[model samples]
Every structure is written in structure tokens, then in C-alpha cells.
Target: MPVAVGPYGQAQPSCFDRVKMGFMMGFAVGMAAGAMFGTFSCLRIGMRGRELMGGVGKTMMQSGGTFGTFMAIGMGIRC
Candidate 1:
């Protein structure tokens, strides 16, 4: 097969590499979703600006932990 090269002259990634890349992209997206969920949940419960800001870190940590666990499980099954 002819190897495709980019501007940096790196050869094209293999199928597994592509899959890993996709998984990382998905992981980032999940983290963003988790952050949004945390923010919205705090707001919906009537938290004010300062309270909301204070809770954001904790909420994001919890959300990220949960999401990371799920992702790990999924990747374990697939890989």
C-alpha cells in the first residue's frame, strides 16, 4: 500500500491508531458534555453566581470520574 504523508512527512496511521484517535476525541466530547450537565444542574437548582462557581469544580470532578469509568469499561470491552 502507498503510504500517505502529511506536511510533516509522517506516514498515515493504521486502523488501530485511527480507532484510538477517535476514542480520544469521544472522550473529550464526553468531558465537555459532563461539564455542561454539571453547570446546568447547578443552575436549575437555583444556585447563584458565587455558589454556582464554587460547586463547578466539585461537580465537574464527579462528572468526569463517572464518565471516565464508563469510557474505560467500553474501551476495555472493545480492545
Candidate 2:
């Protein structure tokens, strides 16, 4: 993407850029939370080895995507 010069030689991010930033931030936070909870949940259910890793990964992606979507929407609206 080309630099977007706005007003006085300063580059400005578009609304989509703001939304994408929001999604990335939310995704990072959500992935951390999901990893913590998913690990405990998988362990409590007696999952071991590869099964445990798979469960954790699945949970992480799901939660991250969900949180990212909401954050993007909220940021887009504010923009």
C-alpha cells in the first residue's frame, strides 16, 4: 500500500486500517486468555500429548477470531 499523505505531509491510516489494528490487538489478548483456559480445561479432562495440544490450539483460534471480529466492528464504528 502506498503512503497516504493527509493534510500536512503526515501519513494517516484509513478506517479499515484502524479496524485491522483493533482486530490484531484483540486477537493477541484473546489468544493469551484462550491458551491459559484451554490448557487447564484440557488437563482437567485428562487430555495428554498431541490431543492436549490440538485442543488448546483449536480453542485459541476460535476465541481469537471471535474477539478479533468484535473488536474490529467496534473500532470501525468509532472511526
Evaluate all candidate structures by whole-model CA lDDT and list the values in order. Answer: 0.70, 0.93
Stretch of 10 with least lDDT, candidate 1: 18-27
Q: Report residue 19 deviation for candidate 1 (angstroms).
A: 12
Candidate 2 has a TM-score of 0.86
lDDT of 2 by residue, 1-79 (tens): 7977988999888898999999999999889989999999999999999999999999999889989889999999999
Residue-wise lDDT of candidate 1 within 1-79, one digit each (tens)? Answer: 6878889998877666655655565566666776788789888998988898877667766666666666655655665
Query: Candidate 1 lDDT (Cα, whole model)?
Result: 0.70
